[model samples]
Target: MSARDVLEHLQRLGMSGYEAKAYVALVGAGRPVNGYEVAKRSGVPRSTVYETLGKLVARGAAYELRGSSDATEYLPLPPEALLDRMRREFDGSVAVLRSALPAVAAAPEGHLIHGLKDAEAMLDRAEDVIAGARRGLVMSVWPEEMRRLREAVVDAAERDVEVSVVSFGEDADPFGGGRPGAVYQHKYSAPEAVLEDLGYRLLVVVGDRREAVVGGFGEGAAWGIYTADPAVALMAAEYVRQDIALQILADRVGAGEIDRLFATDPGLLRLLGRARS
Candidate 1:
């Protein structure tokens, strides 16, 4: 591998800049090298090299030994050994992360949210809701929300959870490939009929217990509401059903070849046909 590639690989495996550089220098030197020479060759600071070397030694990727002047010298562990040690560290971290994450409760579970920060927080809660969902999902989304929403959907899909999305064409596949569900991609009847303006309309309705809605208008940047009430969830579910209906009907014709038979509406079905082409 190239020098840059090896250095990057080390850094990614949790090595500090000096530590990675020192390790690289020792790897090339072909034998133990004193701290000063190691720092000079690696371009690392003399003052910090000892500490960095100690960390590496503790990790078993480096060794300290007697040198020609009775000074301290360091050696890099073999490449495979370094890789194995780092992999074990990564596995343990992943296991800890998996254990810590699944235990977190969605704070407030359901609550109104306003402003950018609250909206962001609400998005996090949406992740927990989707992670725990079993039967189905309904979501209303726009482009700005894509980063978080896409992850939630992909995670759900990866976990085999059902996901369905309703969104304007910010080009987010709320049902992205990871999940085996549906994405409703037809345009709404009117510009007024979106997640906002009609008042806190953006929402995620999961199963029958939780529904989160956040919107004051995508551009107007207003507040939104979230609820655990079955009544509210039911309302959100119905709204999604209606939007999904449009997607279902439109996708069939616009997304498929039904366009030749039904050309009046160029909805999802027509789009699907065009996509196929």
Candidate 2:
């Protein structure tokens, strides 16, 4: 990776810009460097190199050496040593906060929606929600997504959480290709038809009716909205509930009318024809 990329990564791990630059330069230098040399190599201001180097020494990320003519040289702590020290500090801080924070009563969570752009992130969030479900889960997902999260769903069911799944395919394939829970297959409406029209497959997951994640999964532009707003979560869960209801209705009324309904809808027909090809 480039020096810029390394510096950015170090910054993300809690180093300041100058600190990252100085450290990277020191590592690259192999031998100890004076502040002026560090400033030159790191592209840091000459006037501030001493200050940044001092901070790095205090953080145990660099070593200070006394040299001839009263010149002070700075050597980088080995990368492994610096990483280990930082990891210990981070772990300790997290431990202290985790114990202390719960004593304070949490404020009521407001209606908030988070937009997720990565497909893996969306799937991971859904899996976490499923793993945490106590009472129930309702989900509408494609086989591709189901394949990734099936174990979490099955585990939740094993814990006696009521799990309802809607799988979009022609067969009653269990969502996630695992041991089935309460699953309903939507075969009358082609999911590919919807994908063709919308350019994505919509996956909805509501956990314990407390939170929901709704997303559109395309090739590389997947997007999702995660919300804990009670009303919004309920609405999302209701969407799955209604989908299951439609499947029940289809079972009784036969798929002919339902198939025809999708087949004849102008927009659906356009997509359906595309899906067929």
**lDDT of every model, 2 decimals:** 0.68, 0.84
Please provide, for model 1 over 63-175, each residue's C-alpha lDDT reduced to its tens digit, 9 standing for 90 to 100. 98986778888888988888987898899999999889878956665554333336666666667667667767777666556566677777766776667777656465655
lDDT of 2 by residue, 118-196 (tens): 9988998898788778999999988888878877877888899998888887242543345443888875566776677
Model 2 is weakest, by summed lDDT over 10 consecutive residues, at: 170-179
TM-score of each: 0.53, 0.60
Query: Which candidate should be chosen as best, given TM-score against the real structure?
Result: 2
